[model samples]
Target chain A: MSGHNVVAEAFAQTQYQVGGHGKRIVQVLKDVLNEVEGTVEGDMYGSGKLIADFEAKMAEYLGKESAVFFPSGTMAQQIALRIWCDELGLKKVAYHPLSHLEIHEEAGLRELHGIESVLLGEKDRLIQLEEILNLQEEIACLLLELPQREIGGQLPSFEDLQKISAHCREKGIRLHLDGARLFEILPYYQKTAQEVCALFDSVYVSFYKGIGGIAGAILAGSAEFTKQSKVWKRRHGGDLISLYPYILTADAYFDQRIPKMGQYYEQAQELAGLYNQCPRVTTWPEVPVSNMFHVHVELPKAELEPILAAVYAETGVGLTPYVREYDESTSSFEVGIGDRYAQVPKDALHTAFRLLHEKLQNL
Target chain B: MSGHNVVAEAFAQTQYQVGGHGKRIVQVLKDVLNEVEGTVEGDMYGSGKLIADFEAKMAEYLGKESAVFFPSGTMAQQIALRIWCDELGLKKVAYHPLSHLEIHEEAGLRELHGIESVLLGEKDRLIQLEEILNLQEEIACLLLELPQREIGGQLPSFEDLQKISAHCREKGIRLHLDGARLFEILPYYQKTAQEVCALFDSVYVSFYKGIGGIAGAILAGSAEFTKQSKVWKRRHGGDLISLYPYILTADAYFDQRIPKMGQYYEQAQELAGLYNQCPRVTTWPEVPVSNMFHVHVELPKAELEPILAAVYAETGVGLTPYVREYDESTSSFEVGIGDRYAQVPKDALHTAFRLLHEKLQNL
Candidate 1:
C-alpha cells in the first residue's frame, strides 16, 4: 500500500470523505505567517472607514466608480439582478442555463431574491445574440459569464460580446457581467480590465479565486449602484470590521499574480494541446482560450478509478476529471491552473494515460 | 503631544499601517499567537474546507443534526428566515422591531428576501407571548436573538424563553435563534449549549465575534434543514473547498476559550458594578446580566468624540457609544468584554469618566 492508499483508506472511514477527494484537511494557521500581524480583537461589523477604503480600492482595480465587498458572489450577483429587475419593473434576467446563478445557486435568484431567470442559449453552449433576440422584452438585464465554466470553459467571441452589449444598450436593458473568472478571461481577450468592465453596468469579481485570498468578493459598478450594494451587503451580513486581511491578500496577489495571467493563458493552450493528442481523451472546444478547460475521457467509469488512484499514489501528480463520471461509458474532468504545475509535460501526460489504460485493462 | 496623538498622526500620514495592533509584522511567527494564521490561499470556494468543518462542528455544538457556513451572520439569519417563509408557505418572520435584521441589514429582509418582518417585541424590550398572540397566520417563524443586542444586551428570562418556544410549537411556526452574541447569553441562562439550542429549530453563530476567527458563520439545524441549507448556501455562493483555517480557529477557540466563559461572566459582573458607581455614567437596566451592557452619559455629541479618541490615544482602549445621541442632551455607549481587555477596572472607569467630565466642564 502506498501513501495515498493509507490516506484514502483512513478518509474512507469518515462520512464526509468520498473517493479520496475532500481529504487531506488543510492545516490551521496560527501565529503570524504573513508580513502583517493582525489584531486579535473581534470586530466583525466593520468600521465605516474600513468599508470606505475597501470599496475605493476595489473600484480602482476594476475601473468602476465604486465597489462593495460581499461575503459571496452569489449574494452580490443575485442582489444585482434583483435591483435591476426592481429598477426596470421587469420580471426576469436572462443568462445561460448552466450559469452558476442557475445550476449551482439552488434557485436562490428565484427563491431568495424573487427575480426569475430566463435561461437562454442551448442547454450546454455559451449565450449568443440569437438567444438574446428570441428573449421577451420583460428582461431587465442580461447576465453574461466570461469564459462560461459549465460547457468545458467555453467563451463567446469579443465581437459577439460587443454586439450583445450594444444590443442591450439599444434596447434600454442593463448588461451585467458575472465576471467571477474575469481574470482568466482577460488574457484570452487581450483586453485591459477597464475595457472589459466598461462593457457592463456592473461586474462581480472574487478575491479568493485566482487572486488567492481567504474569502471575499467585490461587486463593482457606478458609485450609486455600489452604495445601494453596501446597504445590501450590510443587510446580508457581508460587512466585517477590518477587512484588511482579505484586502492585503488581494493586494499582494494583484501585484504578484495578476501580471502573470498572460503567461498562464499561454500555458493553458499548451496543456490542452497535450491532452488532445491522447487517444482516449477528447479536449473540449479544441483550443484553450482561458486558464480553465475540461476533457472528456472515453473510459469505463468503474475501471478508471482504481488505476488513477494507483497512479496518484505512486506519483504525487493528481489528474482531474477527478472522477466526474458522465455515464457508464464516459467520464469528464475540469482543470484549473494556479501557482501549481502548468503546461503539463508530454511524458507525464503519456505516463498518466498509460496508468489509466493499464487500470482499465486490468478491470 | 500625547502618545496617541503622535501615533494617530503617524498612522494618518502612513495610511494606517496593517498589523500594528497586537504584534509586529514578522516573516516568521515568533510566539504561539493563539493559532490565528497571517495569510490564507485559494478562494474560499476551493480553499474554505475549514468553513465546512466549522459548520459541522457548529451544528454539533448547537446539538443540531447539520449546519452550513456563511460569510455574515446577517446574511445567514436573513436567508434562514427566508427559507422558513418559503418552506412553510408563508411570507413573514416575527422578530423584535429593533432586531439587527431590520435596522442594521438596511431593510434587506424586505428588499433582498422579499419576506416581510412582523415586529413582535416592544420598542425597548424582548418579545413576550402578548406581542405574538396577535400575529397573523402568515407568520412563518419567529427570530429570537438571545440577550438581544440592540436593547443594552437584555435577555428574556429562561421561563419566558420556554414559553416563547412553546408558543411557536403550538402555532406550528418554526423558531430560529439569531445567536450571534450567544456566547454571552449562556451564563445568564445557566443552561448548557445543548439546553439553550434545544429551544430552536435553527441557530446562527458567528466565528469572528465570539470565536475570534477571521470571518465566517454557522447556521445549524436538522439534517434535512442543513441539506436544504447547503443548496441555499451554494446558491448564496458560500460553499468553499478548504475551510480548515476557520474550522481550526473556531475549534481551537471552542476548546481554549469556551470553557472560560464562566470567568468572563464573573468579570463582566464586576465591571458592571464599577460602572454603577460612576456618577457621570448611568448603565442601562442598572447592571449587566451578561458580558455586555450599555452606558448612558449626559454629554454633548461633539465633545464625546474627542474625549473617547483621547482615551484610546492615551491607552489602547476602544470604547463605543463613544457618542450615540438619543436626544440633544444624552448620549449612550455599549461595552463588551473582549480578549484584550477582559474587564474594565473601577479606577479605569473613573479615569475615563473623570477625563470626559473635565472635557465637558471646559466646553
Candidate 2:
C-alpha cells in the first residue's frame, strides 16, 4: 500500500477517531429504514405524503415560502442558479473561484445550461461585499456559500453578509445561499435557520453534510422561485419515481441532530486549539467558526504520513485519515466535528494531541 | 372524491387487479433491504464495490464493455445522446415525436445541452426503417424506444430494427435504445437482452419500469461512451453521495423478476383477448407485443369511469384504475401484466370481464 492508504487503513482501525457523524455506510440509514412500514405507499413521480411533509418542514425551518427536495445538492444548487438566470433573462451568474460549481461539477453549469460564470473572488478567501458591489458582469445571481467551506469553513461577519445581500437586491441580482453546511454555522451565527436564510433570496441546504442523512437536498425560496425550480428539477431528472428513501432519513436525522450544532461547534473550537498548540501545526482562522476547520502542518506530506500512522497506533486516536500536499513543504487536512468526537475517551484524546504536539515540535 | 379518484380507490382495493409488479410503494424494496447487512459499506461519491459491481453486471448483461447507474432514466438517456453528439462533433439528434425526451422531459435535451432534435417519425406509430433511410438533416444520434410505450407498446418486426440499425451505422449516426421496458419485450422478440442490445451503440434500461425497482437506470455502451457519461452524470448531479438504496433494490428485483417476463407476456395476451371481446373495448395492435398493451373504449372517459367502477364493485376485479380521454368519444387505459395478475383468482377475472363486456354492450 502507498503511504496514503497505510495512514487511512491505520486510522480506520484506531479505537477512536475524530471527524464526521459516522462512517458513510449502510448502517447510517438503519435507524430510519427499520421504522419504515413496507405496506405504506411511497411517493410516486414526486408526490406523496412523506416527501411533501419533509419539504414543508424544511421550508418552514428555513423560513421560506416554499421548498423542493432534490436527489443531490449539486442539482439543487445548479437549478437554483438556473432559475435566477431564467427569471432575469440573463445567462450569467457569479461565485467565488473556489465554489463547488467551479471546482467540482465538471462545468455542468456551462455545458448543461449554457450559463457563464464570473468567478468573483481570490481562491484563498471568502467573497467580500466590495466584490459584490462592483461585479463587472451583468449576472443574474450571486451565490455565496455561508461559512465558505472551501477555505476551512471561514465565515464572514453577519453585518457584511447583510450589506452584500442588500447590494445584490438593489442591483436586481438574485442572492443565493449555498448553505450545504448551513446547519453547522447556526450556533456561531447565533441565528435560527430562518433568520440566517432570510438574508438571501434563495437557499440550498444539504441533508448529508452536517445533518448526516443518507443523501438529499432542499432548495427553499419564494413560492414563485420554487415553482420554477420544479420545472428545472424534472429537466435535470431530479424528479425520480420516488425519493422516500432519502426523505425518511433526512427527516429523522434533521430532528435528532439540529440541536447538536452548538455542541459540535464547541468541539471544533476545542480541537483546533489543540492542533494550534503544536509547534509546526496551526489551524486557519486560529479558531473554528463552525463545526469544521483545516489543519496545516509545515512538513511535507510524505514525511507527515508516518507520524500520523504512528500516532494512531500508539494513542488509539486518529486525527485525520489522509494528508493533502498543500505545497512543496506544507501538508494539510480538513476536520469536521460530529458524533465521533464525544465518543472518544477524554484521556486518549489528550494523550494523542500531546504526542502530536511533541512530534511537531521536533519537526 | 372525483370520479377518477373514486375509480382509483376502488381498483386499489380490489384483490384481483392486474398491471405492474405489486404497487409502486415501499414494499417493493423490502426483499432487498431485509437481506442487506447494515454494516456493509455503501458506495460513496459513486465509487465502491456495490455500484461498480452492479454497473459491471448490467454492462455484461447488455453485451457492452461498460455501464453506469443513474438516478433516473431521464438523466441517463439525455447523457447518452449528449455524449454521442459530442463524440460526433454534432449537436443534433432525432427520435420519434413521442419519445420521452420530446414529450415528457420539459425539453431537457434542448434546454440543458443546447442540442436540437429533429422529430423523424409520426407520433402515432413507431419509427420506420424508411425514415432512417431518408434523413432530411445531419444528426449525431437516433434514439429508438423499443416497443413504443406511449402509442401502447407496439413494436415493429425485429427485421426492421436490424435494418434501421444498419442504416444508422452506415450513415455514421449512433443509435441509442431507450429500452426502459427492455426485459418485458425480450419474450416477444425471442431474443436475449444482449442480442437486442447489440443493435444499438448505447442502451438505457430502467429498473423502475418492468424490473419493478425503486428508481434507477443503467446506461450501457462502449468503454469510451460510458467513460464520458460519468462526467455528465456528475454534471447532472445524478452522482449522489451514495446510490446503494436504488442499487440494492434494483439488483434484488432484477434477479427475482427477470425470469418472470415470459409468464407476464402470456398473461398479457390472455388479458388483451378478454378486453377485445367487449363490445366497445379493444386492445391496441389486437395483441400484446410485450407484457403491456393499451385498451381503447368507444365510450367517453367520463361515461366509462362509472362503468369500470361498477364492474370492479360487482366482480371484485379491477380492469383499470384510471381512464384517459383518447378523443371526443374514445377513452383508453393501459395494462401491464405482473405478479399481481397471477395472484388474482381465475374465476373472479372471468366474472369481471363478463361484467365489463355486458356494461360496454349497454353503452
Candidate 3:
C-alpha cells in the first residue's frame, strides 16, 4: 500500500482518533437507526417525510425559510450557483481562490454549469469588502466559506462579513455561504447560526464535517430555491431511493454536536496555545477562529512522517499523519479538534506534543 | 394532500406491495448490515476495499474491465456521456425521446454538461438503426435504455441491438447502455449479461430498480473510462464519506436476484397472459420483453381508481394505485414483477384482473 494508506491503517487501529473513528461511527449509525421511527423508509428519490423533517429542522436551525438535503456539499453548492446564475442571466461567480468549488470540485462549476469563477481575495485570507467592489464583471453570486478551511480555519470579523453582505445586497448580487464548517465557527463569531446564515441568500452546510453525520448536506434558502434544488438534486442523481441512514445520523449528530461547538473551540484554543509554546512549532493565524487550525512544524515532511509514526507507535497517541511540505525544510498539517479530541486528556495531548517536539529536536 | 399522496398512503397500508415494501426493505438492509465484516467502515469518500470489492464484482459480472459505484444512475450516466463527449471533442448524443435523461433528469445532460441531446427515436419505441443513420449532426455517443420504461418496458430484438451496435462501432460512435433494468431484460435476450453489455462502450446499471437494493448504481466500462469517471464522481459530489449500506445491499441483492430474473420474466409472461384474457384490459405488446409490461385499462383513471381501491379493501391483493391517463376514456399502468410479485399466486392476480374487468363493464 501507499504511505498515506499505511498511516491511515495505523491511525485506524489506534484507540482514539483525533476526529471520528470507525467503530464509534458505526455505533452512532446503529444507534440512530434504532431511534428512527415513523419513517423508517424514505421516498424513492429523496421526497418523503424523513428527509423533509431533517431539512425543516436544519432550515429552522439555520434561520432559513427552507432547506433541501443533498448527498454532497459539492453538488449542493454547484447547483446553488447554477440556479443563481441562471436566474440572473449571468454566468459569473466570485469567490476565494481556495474555495472548494474552485479547487476541490475539479472545476465542475465551470465544466458542467458553464459558471466562470472570478477569483477574489489574496491567498490564505478572507475576501475583503474592497475586493468585491473592485470586481468589474457582472456576477450572479458571491460564495463565502466560513472558517476558510484551506488556510487553517480562518474567518473574517463579523463587521467585515456584514460589509460584504451589505455590498452584495446593494449590487443585487446573491451571496452563497459555503458553510461546510458554519456550525463550528459560530462560537468564534459569538453569533447564532441564524445570524451568520442571515447574511447569505443561500447557505450549504455539511452534515459530516462538524456535525459528525455519516454523510449529507443541507442547502437552505427560500422554499422556491429548495424546490428548484430538489429538481437539480434528482438531475445530479443525488435523489436516492432512501436517505434514512444519512438523515437519521445527521439528525442525531446535529442534536448531539451543535451545542458542543463551544467546547471544541475551547479545545482548539488550548491546543493552539500549546503548539505556540513549542520553539519549533507555529500555528497559522496564531489563534484559530474555529475548532480547526494549521500547525507548521519547522521539520520537513520526510522527517516529520517518521516522527509522527514513532509517536503513535511508542505512545499509542495518533496525531495527524499527512503533512503538506511547504519546502525542503518545513511542513504544515491541519489539526481539527472534534469530540474524539475531547476524549483525550489535555495533558496527554501536551505529552504527545512534547514527545513530537523532542523527536524533532533530536533530528 | 394531493390525489397521488392519498393513493400512495392507501397503497402503503396494504399488505401486498407491487414493488418492495418498506418493512421488507428495512429487513434486507439489517440482514446485509449484519453480514458485512472486516472493513465495516469505508473510505472517507468511496475509496476503500469494501467499495472496490463491490465494483470489481459488478465489473466481472457485466464483463467490463472496471466499474465504479455511484449514488445514483442519473449522475453515473451523465458522467459517462460527459467523459465520452469530452474525449471525442463532440458535444452531441442521441437517445430515445422518452429516455430517462430526456424526461426525468431535468435536462442535466444539457444544462449541466453542455451536452446537446439529439432525440433519435419516436416516443415509446426503440431507437431504430435507421434513425441513427439519418442523424445529420456528428454525435459523440448513443445512449440506449434497455426495456424502454415510459413506453411499457419494450425492447428491440437482440438482432436489432447487434445491428445498432455494429453500425455505431463502424461510425466511430460510442454506445452507452442505460441498462437500468439490464438484469430483467437478460432472460428475454436469452443472453448473458456480458454478451449484451459487450455492445456498449459503457453501461450504467441500477441496483435498486430491478436488483432490489435500497439505492445505488454501478457504471462499468474500460479501466481508463472508470478512472476519469472517479474524478467526475468527486466533482459531482458522488464521493460519499461511506457507501457501506448501499454497497452491502447491492452486493447481497445482486447475488439474490440475478439468478431469479429468469423466474421473474416467466412470471411476467404468465401475468400478461391473464391480463390479455380480461375483456376491458390489454397488455402492451401482448407479451412482455422482460419482467415488466404496461397494462392499459379501457376505463379512465378516474373511474378505475375507486374500483382498484375497493378491490384492495375487500381482498388483500393490492393492484396498482396510480394509472397514467391515456385518454379521456382510457388509462394505463405498468406491471413490474419483482420479488414482491413472487409472493402473490397466479390465481389471485387473475381474479384481480377479472374483478377489474367486471367493475369496468358495470361502469
**What tens digits encode model 3's per-residue C-alpha lDDT throughout A253-344?**
89888889998898888878977887678997698888899988888776667777776766666777566787788888888878778787
TM-score of 2: 0.98
lDDT of each: 0.67, 0.89, 0.82
Against the true structure, whose lDDT is highest? Answer: 2
- Highest-scoring model, TM-score: 2
Q: Can you list the residue pairs that collide in candidate 2?
A: none
- Per-residue lDDT tens digits for candidate 1, residues B1-363, read 233443244323321121111211221122323444334332345334445556666777788888876656776787788778889998888888888887777887787667887878687776776676667646899998877778778887888788888888998899999887787678778887779989999998876554555556788888887777667667655564344444554566566667666666676676666556655567765667666777776765555556666755554344552357666877676666655344444455556556655655565
lDDT of 3: 0.82
**Two-chain DockQ for model 3:** 0.53
What tens digits encode model 2's per-residue C-alpha lDDT throughout A314-347?
Answer: 9999989888888999988999998999999889
Candidate 2, B154-208: lDDT as tens digits: 8989999899888888999999999999999999999999999999999999997
Docking class of 3: medium
Q: Which stretches of candidate 3 lie over 4 Å from their true place?
A: A1-16, A20-28, A37-39, B1-13, B18-28, B133-137, B345-347
Steric clash count of candidate 2: 0
Candidate 2's DockQ is 0.81
Worst 10-residue lDDT window, candidate 2 chain B: B1-10
